[model samples]
Target: MIYRADPARYDAMQYRHSGKSGLKLPVISLGLWQNFGGTRDYPSAMEILGHAFDAGVTHFDLANNYGPPPGSAEELFGQVLARDFRPYRDELIVSTKAGYYMWPGPYGEFGSRKYLTASLDQSLKRMGLDYVDIFYSHRYDPNTPLEETMSALAQAVRSGKALYVGISSYPEQETREAHRILAEMGIGTTIHQPSYSILNRWIEDDKTIDACGELGIGVIAFSPLAQGVLSGKYNQGMAEGTRGADPRGSLRASHIEPRVLAAVDKLGAIARSRGQSMVQLALSWVLRRKEMTSALVGVRTLEQLKDNLGVLNNLELTADEIAAIDEASRDGLMELHPRPSGWLR
Candidate 1:
């Protein structure tokens, strides 16, 4: 069947500029970090991608080591792009990253110029693209000189392998330095990808969010549901096939502590009051900040994608609701009792 994108795709969705860059991304972006890998079902993946694009989710985020086998997610997305989205290519914002153990070699995993340059080439090849919209250093390499990493990213822009460059999971100071280094090289740092959710607030505590806002770098939050913990899925307990139940998954059983579940329950109650699902509430909370340019969601099924998209129906949260959320989060409550509301404070 011929795949034509819905004509109304752009009508309901919202777009925000990536930091000070001219590029604008959808308020909600789809991430191929999981479920689009080799082990997943192909037709199902195609349906999800098609549905997402139809609903105006123009940004699709990927990384070199995203798949369990590495590089498979890009391969999968590449196939879908060719078969379904060839004509609408210009309408999409496709991004990928490198900076993990992509291969077993000394130069395979860091922010070195050699690794970043090579990884971008491999990623472009795997995605069957002339250039990606954004290329990111997946993580900050403590051992690599910051200049070296930013230089590699600058080269990507100069060589036209990527339209923009970004950093993921970098510390506050490193993010500032990266922007400075890239600017000196005549390139603007476009976006910052970080793990942010109701449960994971490290970016806030560490002031990375503040730094991005000050630097004019957009923030796209990954795991805004805290790897599905904020979805109220683990409230009852870890199900058989949930991420927490999978030992190899990033969301471990230990992450869903009793206190955390208690917090989620409180959050769920707030969601119900707002006539929203836990997923919708979680996403809305992440997007509440002006600095949050997008919430990057990874969904396993089309139904889950629909549920996530429903968040757009009620994107705004009242100030009192925000305060309630802060009180309920309990700072993920490491202590036996709840702490003062940091957000309210």
Candidate 2:
């Protein structure tokens, strides 16, 4: 059967302007970093993507090296687009990045124009896209000249391969420089994708969030649930299929120490008091910042995706609730958690 999107999709979700740009993003954007890869169950991915679009998620985030084998996520997403989303292409905001490791050789990765340009071409081909809505640098390549990276992003826009350019996980100072260089190139920085949640507040402490607010670069927080820690799944103990049990997963048992569990327990209590689940509270807390344009969530199942979308129904976080989360995260939460190593392919 041919898939037709709901006519009332726009009415299902609220949209926010990305930074100061005219483009707007659904408050709950979907990230294809995990289950959309080629190695994963294709039918499951199709279900989630279909439901997400039906529920009004317009933005779908991807990267060149997202899958376990790398690049497969784009390959899979391309298939989905051709099959079910071709008619809705104009309404969707599809983005991909290239700074991380892709191919083997030295020039295969990082911020070089050669790598970025070639990677985007490959991505466009894999995703069957004429041009991506946004292309990101993926990370700060300290080894490469900042000018070189920014110029490559400019080249992407100049070549009409990307409508906008952005940077991810860049420090405040570096973010300022990149934004300046992009403006000089006549292409304004669109948004920044960072790892932010109650457990990980480095963006706030490092002033990246503050800098983005001042510079007018929108922030879409990835890992807003802290890699499932804030989901309350491990409050009692790690389950068989949970991230804590998966050897290759980002979350480890050590990450859920007793102190963290206690914090989660307190948070769960607060969530119940508000008639919301732990995941909903975590997402609402992240979106509380006026500077936050959207929250990028990765869902493994259709139920999880729907739960994430339901957060938009009640985004209000009371002052006391916010303070409670702050107090709970204050102790032992200062440890630097591992962000996706942008260098790793």
Candidate 3:
């Protein structure tokens, strides 16, 4: 079935400028990290994406290794663009990353000029895009010199293959260095994708988000629902058919320890008191940060996507509610969770 977007969906969405850049992102964005893989059933992906655009999600996030087999997510997303959104291409903000394991050999991953350039080309081919709206270095590579990585991103923009470049899961110090080098090369660094949620706050503690405004980089917070740990669905008990059972889902049994469950219970009550579901409350908390430009979320179904978009209806997180969340997490509630690749320095 061909997909279509609902034009009247913007009545409830509020947009924010990405860092200091002129581009604006809706409060919620879609991440193709899970369900949009080529190995998965294509109909499900088209359903969620169609619902997303109809619900006012303009941005789509992708990475080189987002699927069971690497690069399939981009390939699947390309099919989605062709099947459903060809005419609306000018209004979409599609992004893909390339720093993780892609092709397997030495140059297949990391921050070398050869790896990045080849990765972008491969991503473009999979995405069926002449140039991506944004391209990202999926993670930092200490082994490769920073100059070589920055040059690769510069080359992407110079070659008109990527309109903007970004870094993901990088430390505050590395973020500053990359921003500086990209600026010197005259390549624009538009945004940084990082994991941030009520249960995860390392980016806030390290001040990487605050520094983005100073460095011309916007912030996209991924996993804002903390792998569903912050939602009412998990507040009762291990919900059947939840992400916990998914093979690629990152939530470990240790993450569902007694204390974390207790925390979710308390937080869930607070969300109920405000007449919103725990998922909505948790998502709103991430957007509570003025520095965060968008919340990039993953979903297995269209229902989850719509529930997440409902967060746009209430961006009003009161000061007292903020304090309540802090109080609930006071027992070092999931403090300083590492930024994917390794612990933050």
The window of 10 residues in a row where model 2 has the poorest summed lDDT is: 336-345
User: 1-345 in candidate 3: lDDT tens per residue?
Assistant: 556678786777778888777888888999988667766777878888887888778899987787756788888888888888898899899998888777757888878999999888888888899999889888889888988898898999999998888988888888999999988998777899888888888898888887887886889998888777887566567666676766556676755677887888888888889888888999889988778899988888788888898887787888999999898866526654444464211
Ranking by TM-score: 2, 1, 3
Q: How are the candidates ranked when ordered by lDDT, highest leading?
A: 1, 2, 3
Q: Which stretches of model 2 miss by more than 4 angstroms?
A: 332-334, 337-345
lDDT value, candidate 1, whole model: 0.88
lDDT of every predicted structure (CA atoms): 0.88, 0.87, 0.82
Best by lDDT: 1
TM-score of every model? 0.95, 0.96, 0.94
Better of 1 and 2 by TM-score: 2
lDDT of 3 at 287: 88
lDDT (10s digit) by residue, model 1, range 1-345? 788899999998999998888989999999988678988766888899999999999999999988866899999889888888899999999999988878877998878999999999999999899999999988888788999999999999999899999988887888899999988899998999988888888888889999999999999998889889889988877788778878778775556888888899999999999999999999999999999999999988899999999999999999999999999997573211112111100
lDDT by residue for model 2 over 192-287, one digit each (tens)? 988889888888888999999999999999989888889989886778867687888777565688888888888888889888989999999999
